[model samples]
Target: MSAPPLNPKAGLRAALLLLLCAVALVSITAAPAAGAGPGSPDSRRGDRTVVRTEQGLVRGLSHGSYTTFDGIPYAAPPTGPLRWRAPVPATAWQGVRDATRPAERCVQMPAPGASGVTGSEDCLYLDVTVPTAEPAAGKRPVMVWMHGGAFLGGSGSDYNAGRLSVQGDAVVVTVNYRLGIFGYFGHPGLGAAPPFGLADQQAALRWVRANAVRFGGDPRSVTLFGESAGALGICAHLTSPTAAGLFQRAVLQSGSCLTSFPRGALAPGTPAYEPFAPEAEVQMVGTRAARQLGCTEGGNEEVLACLRGRSTDRLATAQLMQSFNRPAFGNGLLPEAPARALASGRFHRLPVMLGTNHDEMRMFVGLSLAAFPIRTEGDYRARLTEAFGAAAPAVEARYRAADHPSPALAWAAVLTDRSFTCTTLAAGRTIAEHAPGLSLHGYEFDDPHAPVLAGLPANPDFPYGAAHGFEMPFLFTPFPTERPLDEAQRTLSDRMVAYWTAFARTGNPNSTDAPPWPALRMSSPHAPSVQSLAPEPGGIHPVDAYATHQCSFWDRLSR
Candidate 1:
C-alpha cells in the first residue's frame, strides 16, 4: 500500500490494526487442528512408513496419493531458559519418533469464538508432505509454506498440502514459529538477538537443507512461499544476510516489503500501517510490557528472568501480544527494515513471484463495515478526509463512490489500490531494479466469484469478490471454503498448481498448459507485465496492475 505519514499515537493504532488483519486468516476454520507432542499415539502405526532426518527417523502416515510426516521438531523448544534466545538444534531422539499428528500450535492470540489464549510455547515444529508418486526422474522440488496470522496466530500444520504436493509432484513443508509476544518480543538485555519467530523459520530451512534429499527432494531446489504475515516473514528473510542459500526461489502472496495501509484504511482515525518496526522501538514496547507485568525494579537479567517466569496466560493477553506483532529490524536477522533494504538493493537476488487479490481490501473493509459504517458518499468523503487530510479531495476525485455499487465498496477499492495492489507491484519493481537478471514474475488472483472462506462475516449486498485469501483453496487442500468450487474453479486450481510447481522446478512459472505469464518490466512506468489469474476463459492473461490500480496517483500522494 502507499505509505501515509503518521503521528506517534496513530502509529500505535495502525500497528494494532495491522495485527487485526490476521483476523482474515483466523476466520478460516478449515486448517487441521494441531495435536500433542511425542506422546500422542500413532493411529496409523500399522501401515505408516519412516523417513530419516539428519537428527533421527520419523514415521509418517500414508494417505494413498501422498505421505505426511507431521509435527517434526526443527529446533529445541524455545521454552523456559531458551525463551527470548535464538533457536538451537533440536535434540536428537532415539528410535522412530511419532509424526502422525501435529504438534501444539505456537502461543498466539485466541481466534474468534475461542476461550483463553490457545496453543503451547513449545511450538517450533514443521511438517513434510510428499507425493506418493515421486517425479518420473530425479528429486522433486521442495516448497516450504509459512502460514499467515498477523504473527499472532496460525500453525504450520493447519494447511493440508496434500493437494499441492500430489498435483505438483513436489515435496511441501509447512512451519510453525513463535507468535506475538513470545516470538517478536525484544529487550535491551537480549543485545542484537534476532526475532525468534524469524530465527525459527531459518532453523526450519536449515532442517530442510539437511534432510530434503532423504525425502526425495532437491535440497538446493527449494521455494519459500507464504501469504499475509507469512509473506512479511519471507520479506524479512529476503533481506536477511543470514538467509543466503536457504532457498532458490520465493513466492510472496498478499504481502510485500512496502505493503502498508493508509490512515483510516481499517477504521476512521487509524494511522498508516506497515508490518515492520525498528529494533529500538520494539525494545521500548517490550520494556513497557515488562513493567506492566510488574517485572519492574530490576536490572536486565532480573527483569528478563521475572518476565520469563511469568505464566503464558499472563503474557498472551490480547493487548500485550498484539502490541508486539510487528517484527523488529536492526538485529542480526534483520539489520534494517525490509522496505528500506529492498529500496537500497540489499536483498537476496533470487527468482521471486509476488501478488495480491484483485479485491484485496474488501475482506478487511467488509468485516469492519458493521463497526465503521460508510453508507453514502458523504461517509466515504469523511473517511478520505480522516485518512488523507489535505489530499482527501485528490483521492476522492480518483475513487468516487458513484463509480462502485456502494460507498463501502468504493472505500474498499481505495484501500486495495493504495495498500495491497500498488505496494506489491512496487516491491516487484524494487526487486527488478536491484537484480535486473533475476527471474521475476507477478500475478493478480482476480477470480471475482472466488469462494469465501468459512466464518467470514460478509454482507449479502457486498460480495467479497476475489478478496484477500480467497485464492488459497486453489492451491492448498482442506482450506474450508464456505462452499465447494464448481467445475470451472476446480479447473483453474489445476492451472495454478501447474504454474506454481513449474516455477519451483525451474524458477519459471510458464508452461505449455497455461497462458504465458509475462515478466514485470523493471523500467516501465506502467509495468503491465503481471498475469491475471481467474477461472473464466481468457482470464489468465497479463494486465498492467500498476496502471490499472492507479498506483501513479498513490505514488504521488505518498510523496
Candidate 2:
C-alpha cells in the first residue's frame, strides 16, 4: 500500500488500487444520448423511460443506445440511530422522482491523495443502466456491481455502465453501500447478525428483484460482480444464506474467498489482512474505537448511542476508519469463514468466473520501494524472512533476483505467487472439486503492456506488468490511465466486454465472435486450464494457471 498523501508515495499502491477500483466501478458509464428532439435523427423514438418502483415512479435519461436511472434509493439511509444496523425499506415517494444524479456515496475515509473525507451517511442508493433498444418480450439479464475500497472507501457512482449496458445488452446496476466504521462496526449492543455493509448490498439485491422488471431487467437472471473488495463481498454472498436466490451467477476479480495477504505483503511491517474478522475481534476493536472517541461513559447500548450521535466527519478519519475494514464473520451474515466453507463444500452451487492478474503483487511492492526499499538480494531475503519466517529460505530459493530485472521484481513475483496468483488457482481447483457440475471458468489478464490505472511514479527497473486490478480497464471503458488504448488494446477490450456480457447472458462466456473460452477441466486438477486474456493475437488462449503460478509449491509450504 502507498503511504498517506503527505508522503506522495505513501500507500501509493493502496491509494491507487482504491482509486483504480473506483474508476473501474465507474467506467461502465455509457455515452450521452445520440440526438435531441423526438423527430430528430438521434431521438430515442419514444417518451422518456419511466419505471414505477415500489417506492415511487422514476424518470431516467436515454443515451440513444442505453437508458440510465441514477441515485435510486434501494433502502432507507443508515444514518443517525440507523447507523451500523441492517438496512430498512425505503419510504415511498409522492411524485415521479427525477433519477438523474447519483446519490451521495456512503460515509468513508479519504482515499490517499483525496482532500478530505467524502460521501454521506444516507448512501443506500443504486444506479441502473439498461439497453435503449427495447427487448423483444422477456427482460434482459441484470448485473449488480459492488465497488471496491478494501471495505474502507469507494462508491457505486464511480463506475459507468454504458458499455456494459449498450454493448452487452444487459441491465447494469451499480450500488452505494455503507463503508468504513459506519458500515462494518460491531459491538456487544448489536445483535449477532448483519455486517451492515454486506447487509446493504443484500438489500440492494432485494430492491433489484422487486424493481428489475420496471427497468426491463430479469430478476431471475441477476449476476453479482465486483473487483478487489467488491469481489470479496461477492464471495461472502456466495456463501451467505441470506443471499440465496438473490443472484444466479457470480464473478470474483482479484479477490476471492481464499484471497489473503501475508504480513508485510503490501508494505513492509503492515499487518496481514483477511477479508473477514471474527465478531469478537471486531467488537473489541469497536470498544477501543468507542473509548477513543469518548463514548465509553455508559453501557454498551449507551456507548453505541453516543457513537451514533457523533458527526460523520468525526467518525470518518483515515486512522479511525481503517480500523473497521474487515467484516465480522460467525454472525447471521456469514456463519463461518468463506474459505473454510468452500473447503467443506458449503458454498452456493452457482456458476462462477474467478481469476487474477499475472503480476498481482507488483502494484503493492512497487509502491513501497521508497519507504521500504529492497535494494539488494539481502533486502529481498530479509523481507521473505519477515513475511514467511521458516519458509523464507525455500521462497528465496524458488524466486531468485538474478532471474528477474531487479530485486524488487523478484520480491513482487514471490508475493504474487504466494498471495494472489497461486491462491486464486487454488480456489479454482477447490471449487472445481466441490462443484464439479458447475460452470467454472478461470482467467489470467496478461497484458504485459497494459496501461497503469493507478498513478505511480515511473520506475526504470519495475514495470508493473499486468499488475493487480489492471484488467479492469479492458472490461470497463475510459478508466484513468497514462494513455488511451490503441487499436489492438481496444480490440481486446471489446472482446473482454463480450465475454463478460456473454457470461452474464448465459453461464458460459463463449460467443460466436470471441475465441473459445473453455470451462475449468477437473481432469487436470493440478494444472487446471485458464483463459489468458491479453491484447496480442492468440492472446486469449487456455493455459495451466496452477502450473504457471507454481501453486503446488505454495500448497506444500502452506500445509
Candidate 3:
C-alpha cells in the first residue's frame, strides 16, 4: 500500500491558518480576570480565593467554602520558536499575582462560529479550587479535571469546582491546553517531539506537584478526572512514563482509549494501518502558510518564523472549523494508540473509576443532524453497517426498534452502545486484565433531567435523556443560570456530590447514606454488575447495563 501522506502540509496549513486568526479576536475580547484576597474574613469557602502558590502569591475568592484560584500559569506560553515544542516551566513571579479571573483559553477550532471566546498560543494555564478546611489537616486529596470537547474545544474556566472542592472536600484543579493543529501537528524541524496537549497536561501536573503543598494539598494523592477528550487524555497519561508519579488515581467519564476514530489508518480488509498525515505533510502546511504570507522557499525556518509573526487571526478562519485538527500519531508522549498500550500491560497501576452516561451519541447525532439523520429502519441499518460492518446485522438484531420504545429511542440506544457503553466497559475490563492489583470501578449516570445546550433541541420530557455530558452540571457548579436544575435535580446533584466526594476521599464510593456502588469484577458470576446511578424511589444499585446493550456481541467484535 502507498505510504500515508508523508506531508499533511496542505491540510494543516489550510486548517491552522484559518483558526489561529479567527480566535485571536476572542482572546482580546475577554475582560482581564480579577483576583480575590486570601484569609480575608469575607472569604466564603465555596467562593473564589487567591492564595499564595509556589510560583507566587495570588488572590482568589470563595464559592461557599471552596477557594478558587484561576488562570495560574503552569507553563511558559508556547509561542515564537517554542510553538509545537513540549511546554517549559513557567517563570517564577514576584509578590502576589492576581488570579481572580480566568486566563485566555488555549488556541482551538471555535464552536462552529467566530462568536465564541477567542484563544491564543500562550494558553497553558490552570485553575485550582481547594477546601478551606484543607490547612487544618495540612493536606487534602487533589482532583485534576480535564475538560471535554473532542480534543478541539473546551476550557477549564467553563467548569465550576464548587461541588468537588466544597462537597468532595478536595482540591480540584482544571487546566487549559493547546488544541487542534497548534497542539498536535508534527514536523521534521520539530525534532523528536512530545504531544503538545499531553505535554501541557504534564506541565500542569508538575506545577501541582511543586505547588499543591502551598494550597494545603497532598500532591501524591492527586486523582486525575476528566470527561470526553479530557478522559482520553487521562488514558494517555496512564501509559506515559513522563507522567508517572504525578497522579495516584484516575476517573474517566464517558470516553475510552480503545474508541479512537482513526482517520485513514488502513482500508477495510487491509492488513496495514498508518497515519493519514506524517511529518512531511505537517511541514508542508507550515511551508504553504509561510508562502501565503510571502516567505521564501527552502526557508522552512524563516517560513515558520514569518507564520508565527502573523496575527493568530490571519491563520485561523471566522468559523473556526476543525476538519483537519485531530490528534497525530508518533508523538513520544502518546507513542501509539492508548488501547494498544493497555493491552500490552504498559499502563500505570492505580485505582481507576470508569463509566459512561446512558445516551452518549444523541448529542452528537442531534447536533450534527445532517450527518447522522435517521429517518427509517433501512437508513439506521445502513448507518449501523458503516459503524459496525460485519457485526452490524448482529448489533441490529439485539437493538431492533421492536426492542426499543421507538425509532428515535432505537437510534439513541445504538449510538449509546457503539460510542460509549461498550467502549467504557472494554476499558474497565482491559485495565482489570492488564493491571490486576489495581481497583477498578465502573458506573452509569442515568439522569433524565440533564441540561440541554443552546444549539440542541429542547426536550420537554426527554431532550437530553441521560445523554453525553448531561451529568456534568449535577457534578459541578451550575453555570448559565437559565439551565439550573429543579428541586428534584438538586436532590440528585447532592447525591452525586456525596458519591463522588466519597470516592475521592476513599478508593471506593460507598457510604452509609450514599447509594451502594459495587466494584467491577471481570470474573464475576453474578447477574448484577456495573453500578448504576439513577434518581428513583429504588435508589442507585448494581444493574446489568451491558446485557441491555448486547455487549456480548460487541466484545466479540472488539476482540
**Which of the numbered candidates is closest to the native, going by highest lDDT?**
1
What order do candidates take by TM-score, descending? 1, 2, 3
**Residue-wise C-alpha lDDT for candidate 2, range 1-559, written one tens digit per residue:** 2122222344444544443334332233333334422222221344546778899878777667777789999898788788888899999999779887788877776655667667788889999988778674578999998987777667777777788888888999999888778888888888685789999999999999999887889999999999888998998999888899999999899988888877677665555668788888878777778887889887878998899999888888776676777888999879998898889888899999988999988877776676678889999888888889988898888888888889999999888888887787778778889888899998899999988764665787789899877886786665657777889999999998899888998988998877899898856665547999989989989998788777889989999
TM-scores of all candidate predictions against the true structure:
0.94, 0.92, 0.84
Q: lDDT for each of the candidates? A: 0.85, 0.80, 0.67
**lDDT for model 1:** 0.85
Candidate 2 residue 345 Cα shift, in angstroms, is: 1.3
Models sorted by lDDT, best on top:
1, 2, 3
Name the 10 consecutive residues with the lowest summed lDDT in model 3: 262-271
What value does the lDDT take at residue 154 in candidate 3? 70
At residue 446, candidate 2 shows an lDDT of: 95
Highest TM-score against the true fold, candidate: 1
Q: What are the per-residue Cα lDDT tens digits for candidate 1 across 257-332? A: 9998767777765656788888888888887888889998769999999998999999987677777778888988
lDDT, candidate 3, 304-359, per-residue tens: 56656766665554222243244544566766667777888889998888899887
Runs of candidate 3 with Cα error greater than 4 angstroms are: 1-50, 113-117, 134-138, 261-296, 318-325, 370-372, 459-462, 525-527
